[model samples]
Target: MIKLIGILIVVIGFILKIDTLFTVLLAGVATGIVAGLDFNQIFTILGDSFVSNRGVSLFILTLPVIGVLERYGLKQRAVSLIEKLKRLTTGKVLTIYMIARQIAGALSIRMSGHPQFVRPLVNPMAQAAGLSNSDELKESDEEAIKALSAASENYGNFYGQNLFAGSSGVLLIASTLTQFGYNVTGLNIVKASTIMAVIALVVATIQFTLYDKKLNKSHKK
Candidate 1:
């Protein structure tokens, strides 16, 4: 069908590495034209869609605030706090944070997050632990430490959120299964999520141990 021309345009535009927003807009215009819509109609549709989904841009508001905080030595304070705890290695600190993050998520506390928590606090603390343990870390090692900190937050949130009694994910799962005539319940979903959370915690602990060993080995060389 000629209407499918938009799909082809999308594939071609992506293959050409065109700007994503431009590609999508162009494809939408082409599709609208092929479907017999005029320029005003297409523009109106795009405007309406943008207005409907404007909440997605709410994060933009936090950028300047985060920048101001970073300029005020937010990272330095986090590192200083971690430095006082002499026994906490990078891996141990991240592992402990991961556990706390998971527990918080399960309780629906929603306290830990990437932009609000990780960048401003968790990352600096983790980096400080690494610096405290070693004379100096290579740039690559420092980057890896930051990546691990972010990953720990993500892992904990993903596996633990489902354990919340009335989490959206659990409701969605129950609703979808019920639609297919399956008798899945919210309680069962919570139980399964708890089991998964426990498994993830075990795996995370082992991973942290291995990561610490690797860091120690690198420092020895």
Candidate 2:
């Protein structure tokens, strides 16, 4: 279909690095026009999306604060603290942090255990624990590894958070659904989240265990 082709064009154009964001926006507008929407309606849709996801803009402020905190020694503190614990393995430390991250999220605390924390802190600590040489990791590989670590934190947090009685996001969703004549309850959502979080924890633990075994074998070689 023409619409599907248009969607693929947007995806391929971005992948090809062909001025993607601007091009996609323009192409999307053109698609809307073809779908019988006027230019004014298209603009209104864009405006609505931007306004609805305004929380995204908070990233601009949050990033700078995270950067400043790192500059002031957050990374150093995390690594040094981990280093002092001689009994800890890299995988163990990450696994423990994963637990802590999930617990914090469940309590509705949006703690970002990401690049600022994990890369400069957790990954290096992990490498030190694993006795890994930085040179052994290709830049892309390192980035990928760090990205995985970051992603795990997000998963842990998202799934863990809302285990509490009053997570704002959970409440907001429940309230909105109720208003729309859906009988969703906060406790119901929280209970489902707890089940999902347990499943994810089991799965993630298995993955890390396998990865640790591979790293151990590599270290022996």
Candidate 3:
């Protein structure tokens, strides 16, 4: 019961905007002790997990860089560049950005859109698409657009990344399949990845077509 309370405390604390890492660590320590982990062992596990994921902390580097870039109007330039292309709609503009970002990720170039770049470009472009100037969006419309944007990015990476021989997932998949008596090789996996990429591209094309129609209606309004 005490261990369960610790877990509840950690979860509730985070949801309530309390210090999350401390809460979670405290809960974990309590749970580990309850489960008979000695203090040393608990610390060791914690250290291992922390060290293993330390690279994720590098994301912090982006925030200041984005802020500096945005202050200089990088995002404005991105938006303005697209705006000048009178044929581009908000959805189309965002779609292109998503595709390009994903492709970069697959190639291990690793890029992201956010407060520094996305808000300056995507948000304004969408506004230009004839959405009400009001700052609010209908929940349904927001959800739909968000889903489309997420899907575009995910599909781009999914279809492109596996092409690399060095991709860990390719090796993992091949190994797992071999265990199941499948005779898959690295080359075969690459071919399969190519096929999947083609499928994803087709789906993206269809979505773009639909979004184009929506943009037309928006412009007409």
CA lDDT, every prediction?
A: 0.86, 0.72, 0.68
Q: Sorted on TM-score, highest at the top, how do the candidates line up?
A: 1, 3, 2
Residue pairs clashing, model 3: none
Residue 67 of model 3: what lDDT?
Answer: 76
Q: Write the per-residue lDDT of candidate 3 for residues 57-162, one digit (tens) a residue.
A: 7788878877788799875776566556666654665567656754664566655545444555555565444243323445655566655655665666667777
Give the worst 10-residue stretch by lDDT in candidate 3: 127-136
- For candidate 2, list the clashing residue pairs, or say none: 105-161, 106-160, 106-161
> Model 2, which residues run further than 4 Å from truth?
1-65, 132-144, 172-183
Weakest lDDT window of 10 consecutive positions for candidate 2 = 129-138
- 98 in model 3: Cα distance from truth in Å? 4.4
lDDT of 1: 0.86
In order of listing, the candidates' clash counts read 0, 3, 0
- Top model by lDDT, which number? 1
**Tens digit of lDDT per residue, candidate 1, span 32-99?**
99999999999999999999999777767777888899999989988999889988888888888889
Q: Per-residue CA lDDT of candidate 2, range 1-221, in tens?
A: 56555687787788888996786787778777778889899999988988999988776777788778878987677667766776765567667767888888776676656744676676766655554422254465445456557756776777787787588868987899899999989998788888898898888777766766766666456
Tell how far residue 93 is off in model 3, in angstroms: 2.4
